[model samples]
Target: MTFQSSSKPQAFAPLSAESMAGGVYGWLTPYLIALAKQNAHIHSRLLHLTRTELHFIALCLALMGEKRDDADHFGAFARDYDRLPRRSLLANYIDTAGPGYSPKLATLVSKLAGRPWRMRSYLRLGELYAEPHARKTLCHLASISRWHLIALSRLPAPYRTYGVLRKIRKRYDLACVMFGIEVVRRVRTDMTDRQIIASLERSDTSRIRDWVEAHYERLPFPTAPTGALTDGTGAVSRPVATARDLFRAAREFDNCVDRYLWEALTGRSCFYRCDNGQRRIAVAELKRLPGVGWAVDEIRGPNNAELSGPERAQVFAMFREAGVLPAPQALSRFSWFDLE
Candidate 1:
């Protein structure tokens, strides 16, 4: 089933309620009816939908099952259909008619819509859907979180095969649930996926977390541009340059700064330690926005607590002095962390 269109097709007439109620397009009726309750002019919008958009909605409705009642899902699909994965992949997955409304489907759709770079791997998964044990393989894939998917995307291509994914599902559940996502992420290096799985299976599980943490803490921090700042009143901020520093900071501040190593490593954002002379205070995260340049994304105290008003004011002043103050609307804008 070819999903690509070589030529511009004639405009399709607006679909009527009756035609959609029972026929080839009948699967879409439930979605249209549910969305119509929220949008009175849904039928009019349907007139503007391309064939691929219609099919995409149907596939989403089918996979989402009862969750299809949410109009925002449909709205997102309609607005970003062109940016979605190849129509062929969608059609092929729909043909499989696998499980419905699994966490995997949600993660898959979210990644497909929000992270276009991951589309190639998903497309590869779509190609594998026709093989034997596809349903089980898909179930395994769906069971893991988006973090695992991100980690999987970074692996060598050969390791992304169905066999490795099965191993990942099992190890991801055991290791991640036990050691947490940060440790799993920290341990993910070149040729480490299979080795980690093997070690977990063969070695004593009790020492794995310590080993992982030690392995992470011993690695030298990668060199990157820093955004360090100081207020000259014993107040200062320094960038977190290594996984070791992040791990130690997480332990000392009683926060999850370690979870953000991927962000820091990828240079999408930077984490900094805020201090007042010898007394540690807070952790500040900064990101470079399109128009805003470098802006403070968040500043949190110990235990991920929000800074007090006075303390926050001081931090903001320091950032302002450094010329990297966050815009009033910056927090409201989309962030890469939203994927988590």
Candidate 2:
């Protein structure tokens, strides 16, 4: 249940939680601040949780998590999340995304915040709403293929943010998703070398649009999650993740996402429950490497509002058969907004 470097493990450098912590240390503040300014209002209105908020919340949750390594060792510093409270003031607007979109979005956001795609779509939803000269990031997403959306939608959780991001960005020549330049960090969990290779293959971007079209309806919604259902539970409250927070996480992701990672070997999903397990890369050092991957423009996956369920299903089938999904682990579930 550790990374052993796939083909050329040594070809690429190593990374770990401890090392990565230091890697992003000095950068977190400025990135978070800038993203906050960019997404201030939109993160307030979206139907999903913002990725930044999700990342911090996930960080908090991870800190309070069961595993020591995953715990928020940053302590009080971590608890002092200004972004969380700033967004709380914005929760009043999440119910304002029109009528139908608002209610369903409310359900979707809560569900996303609770579990499953708490990071991916929520972040996507925020990003879609934030574009300086853009519209329908969802449109782009929808065009991608429902299967890709569905797969990305159904990621498992303790609501891990980075774990999920790496899953999508590392697969299928992900160089095209970013606009110009980006930093990509692919974290491997308990995945064996074979599993890592398979994950990379399953999420090839070449067929991403096709995958999204197929599984449009299969997205995780507020209807079902293996854990707690989002029936107004305090544990899954409508916590507003501020635009600043969401923006920050996205930027950091942008920074790491753009970095070109040849092939990284790590655990399944890069989420390790065992702190005392094997030591792979020096996460801090790895974070510092000249990590710049690809950054494509446009949005394509879900939110297309164009395809039908049957069309989506067919694409889903094709992706499973063809093996180019964002999240192969999500096949068991159909709803993206399912509970935590």
Candidate 3:
């Protein structure tokens, strides 16, 4: 199913009726504006990258997840090789800006790349960054220019946006959710701690998968992996279990029940109001979990505010139905909910 079609068709509602005047949007607007400025600043600096560099930057932004534009945050994790010593394990592999072929990129292409006829964009780019041996087999020569020119050079004659760079930027944004969901599914079924560690030892794709799973599983309502998710380039595909269809229905029912209780208990939809110190701690913790660290910045995002309880409830309901989260616990311990 399409991402939108999976959720309830109801209008996207605010978490709280009372927050209608100004709540989530109010909190997010200024932050969004700041992000726009930062994107411009960063884009201006990125104009000179070759095609190879453009693709790597896209992957980095996708993996970074959230706040990819926060100069301080991005610099803290990206510039200093040892800045977040604890995160050095996940952060190091995607550090193309530091030097040559990114190990993480190498492993990804190694595992996912197909033979020439059917290769997908993601895997093709992965190959570009990782497979030096294959380069001699391909025909194109390298091209580089100002960022705008390079961006324009890649697009069709008639395009809507400023250039292909904008399209590339959007791809990174789309990848945040796609990869996030994929990571959750993989962590739930495909990987084990030992295997994950082994992949890390070799500096491979497993590092990214392992990191995603570790932090995702820590979420309050964790989904167990169903072992049915398939890896592909353009879109995710999963098979439905006909025999367990009833069980899926029951689980969704339970999700609604849990969502209600959560709202009743917390009186807020999203827990976005955590102070800077708390957010810093949370982001830091996530960065250490998987892949390149920047992706978390996008997932958590710069818009920090408690989602109105209703909106929070809606999100939970949607994700639960989508099976991203486990069935809500009837009596989840809320003492920790005080973290908000």
Candidate 4:
């Protein structure tokens, strides 16, 4: 669509409701005035603009702002703006800004305008434009829904890295990405890139409980050879030798023991189910500290509730007789919720 110049002068006329119907044109007046000062022809061109042409002009202003350095080039573009087609205008406007200009913004704006205009997405584009990796990130923004764009833009600054963007681009599953964000943000921040990707890939359900259960399937079974830590008087403690066993223990005891699968697989810690004559009593974690040979890190009853006085005394006495020392203040009670 081409905008034609009219003989009747409506220059400096008040903006009507029809001219600013979608609210997208509200921010363009200030920018247009700023640009008209640099080029006198822009002031005359605004006199005969239709609403459609006004939308196009708003898009152009959004793409190439009224920067002081590019006044000459911007004036040249403004002089010929009425004759250019919609596609040509977008292409030429981005081209005039050189290689650093991200085409993603234009793509997103065009898509937003195709239907009803989304003011939130337009505002979010402005916020994202200031980021260092905005060029790379905007490439993916063109394909996502407006709601997804808003959700992604609201993520924590640390989670807005290129790697995370690549993950979002590849999967295009905002729910899975959100689940991964929660795990890394609240559960474990030290998770590696590969680990985070794996977690995201394994997510099949959006529910937190189901997601945590599915995560257990990715952990490898304990491979290092270790014996059971047992005591006399029918109170025996046996090492959880497999991932399945740990999962089962977590389900039966209603605790988060499965989160320690990484530590167990790496041989840094070992979990044992303490039982008395085939009846489970408590769960224990034995951590191997650098200088301390073997220390009883934690011993908790079902649901992570504390054991009774006698039960605690019995467990401690068993560890003492078995040459296992009590964990020091610095090393005791390691929780997966603690940041690495």
Q: Against the true structure, what is each candidate's TM-score?
A: 0.37, 0.16, 0.18, 0.47
lDDT string for model 1 (140-239, tens) is 5534333444545544433344454443445444444344334655656653666654444443444444445545554545453346777777888887
User: What is each predicted model's overall lDDT from 0 to 1?
Assistant: 0.53, 0.27, 0.30, 0.59
User: Candidate 2, residues 1-340: lDDT per residue as tens digits?
Assistant: 1122222111112224454333222223222322222343322432344544544443322222222122223222223334455344234223233222211222223223232232234434443334321222223332332233343334322112232234455444243332111111122233354453343345544443332222222222221101211222111111112223222323433323212111111110111000012311111101111133111111112221222444334333432332223232132233242211
Off by more than 4 A, model 3 = 1-56, 63-123, 138-140, 143-340
Q: 1-340 in candidate 4: lDDT tens per residue?
A: 2344443332343334454343334546544554454345665565455545555456565555443126555655565565776566666764454334444444444434333233344445555654655535555554544554555576554455445555554334556666756755454445665576556545555444455445455455555234665666898877788777888899888899988877886787778787898677888887775664677777788998878868877777767776776564213344332212
Candidate 4 pairs with clashing backbones: none
Which digits, one per residue and each the tens of the lDDT, describe model 3 over residues 1-340?
A: 0122221112222223344224223422223233223344333443343434334434444344343444555443333322333234235534344324344452232222122111124333433444342332121223322232333333322221222123234434334423543554454466664454333334333234334433332333212122222222222222222213212322432322222223212232222111122222010000111232111111111222233454334333433343443222211223221211
Ten contiguous residues with the weakest lDDT in model 4:
330-339
Lowest-lDDT window of 10 residues in candidate 1?
1-10
Give each prediction's root-mean-square deviation over alpha carbons. 19.9, 32.3, 29.2, 10.0
Which stretches of candidate 1 lie above 4 Å from their native place?
1-227, 327-340
Q: After superposition, how far is residue 169 of candidate 1 from its true place, in Å?
A: 9.1
Clashes (backbone N, CA, C under 3 Å), per candidate, total 1, 77, 25, 0
Error of 2 at 244 (Å): 54
